[model samples]
Target: MSRIGKKPVSVPAGVTASVDGQTVKAKGPKGELSFVVNDEVLVKMEEGSIKVDPRDDSKDARSKWGMSRTMIVNILLGVKDGFEKRLEISGVGYRAAMQGKNLQLALGFSHDVLYPIPDGIQITVPRPTEIVITGIDKQQVGQVAAEIREYRGPEPYKGKGVKYAGEKIVRKEGKKK
Candidate 1:
């Protein structure tokens, strides 16, 4: 009954995919990734695509059906094309740079914040105010971006902080005279 689950996830060229019981693994030009589907959902490789369905008509099974399908799609795309997230720093003395393999951030703090880069992920500082995060796993890329932004979130009054590219900040009125 899940609309998304009904559609088969096609295998793209230059990528190889396989299903082993509840686990789906994909290897592509970008890298290799795998996901273990919930038992409530059934996964199988059919023809040139992957299909997901609920094992039963229960609510739990139906709830996991679409999510399982989407997870499979993400892994396939991740291994093939990877993912990217960009962050922008805005402040009087705020900036970012790559020190060896660590990301050193100066967010108007007393001392610089050093974030150790995780394996399978790359962080680049093209400019002092711009940070680019790239990785094969979509979740990891997003998590790293969020963690970086948490260091100095944008303030509504001055809008000075680290934020995702294209993000809009809601401003508040200043003190009345």
Candidate 2:
């Protein structure tokens, strides 16, 4: 009785979706993406919508049913509108810039950290302290942002480093006098 799996995922007007065996593919104006549903889950198209169900009543099957349905939904939405992640650098000399097809970061380091942009993903620096990552795949976009943030994560005391936009950092008290 997976509540989310019971709900069908509708294909938007401009997006096309197909389910072949365990693989679900979607194509839209943004781009194309696909997800492979687990064998424990059964997927099919019903009246322009995708439906998912567990193959059995076992715990594993039921667990995968909801996850598979969410994965299908992610691809459909990904291909339709894409995804974006924003990172902010908050140090005195920390900044980000686009160097050709790579992202150059100055996170209070002696040398600039050069991160090569991957294919199908776009990185833009609207401002020196702001980094925007966009891609058709939600996972890739999020992974790229995480990798960049790992270079110089925000500290608890001063919170001087790179962090996600609107992320709240828990500050720690400074050394007592």
Candidate 3:
């Protein structure tokens, strides 16, 4: 019933995967990661690949089947190659910098917004307007990026704020007499 669930996830070189009950754990050059699948979804490893299927034909089980499979695949890839997110800061005087272990943001505020870097996650400011967040755990990397972007999300008017790279913001027109 699920196309994605039907396909097996192959284990890449230099990476190891194991299945325990409803959880799949992967260890690789990047780091180690694990995903706990839903009870309705069954997970197993075979022939150096991971397989997922629904335990029943019910709607809830079917709905979690594809998602569970995808989560397993994400953990495997994350352990092998890790994940990365890029953010771009726009507008005058708006920029980002790293002070020790904290990310300092200048977003037209009265005070600089400081964000503490979390363990296992790396935050780099290659340029004043460019922020790169990298981590072996996809969820953590995305959560950190979201937190950073939340500080000053891009606005429609003038499109001035923090936004994901390659993100397009729909511009809003100004009022005229």
Candidate 4:
């Protein structure tokens, strides 16, 4: 029994949702998004809410049931309010700035790192040390942030680099003289 799959996802006001076969589509003020549920899960629109059920009483079906439901819910919310992630840069001469639609990062590298911005996603540098990523698609927003952080991951010794806001880096002691 999947506890999460048992509950239906309600279509909130101002957002429209539809389930056609295995494909679930949602449109809202933010934007429009769609998701294809797994074949092991049965998706349907019941009344004003979306319902998900396992195709069979097998372990695979049960495992995919909750996940399918969550995917539908995430898309719905994403199209309505969108998603955002914040990153902070810390290091000597380390900073970030927006070059037109692209992101320019100075993470102590020999040369500046230029990240080309993707469609439907916005990268903004509110301050030299703060980077904000926003988009209607949750996955894209997170992936873009991760790609930017990959350029210069925070080092444990100095905790200097690009990292998620509020992320704690475990410090390591240097060699004793």
List the RMSD of every prediction in angstroms: 0.7, 0.8, 0.9, 0.9
Winner on lDDT between 2 and 3 is 3
Residue-by-residue lDDT tens digits, candidate 1, 50-150? 99999999999999999998989999999989999999999999999999989999998899999999999999999999999999999999999999999
Model 3's alpha-carbon lDDT is 0.93
User: In candidate 4, residue 45 scores what lDDT?
Assistant: 90
Clashing pairs in 4: none
Candidate 1 residue runs with Cα over 4 Å from true position: none
Best by lDDT: 1
Q: Indicate the residue-level lDDT of 151 in model 2.
A: 98
- Candidate 4 lDDT tens digits, 75-171: 9999889899999999999999988877999988799998999999988888999999999998899999999999999999999999999999999
- Per residue, candidate 2 scores C-alpha lDDT tens digits across 1-177 of 889999999998899999999999999999888898889999999999998999999999999998888888888888888899999999898999888988999988889999999988999899999999999998899999999999999999999999999999999999998
Q: How does residue 159 of candidate 4 score in lDDT? A: 95
Candidate 1 vs 4: which has more TM-score: 1
lDDT tens digits by residue: candidate 3, 68-143? 8888888888988889999999999999999999999999999999999999999999999999999988889999
TM-score of 1: 0.98
Off by over 4 Å in 4: none
| Distance from true location, Cα of 99 in model 2, Å | 0.6
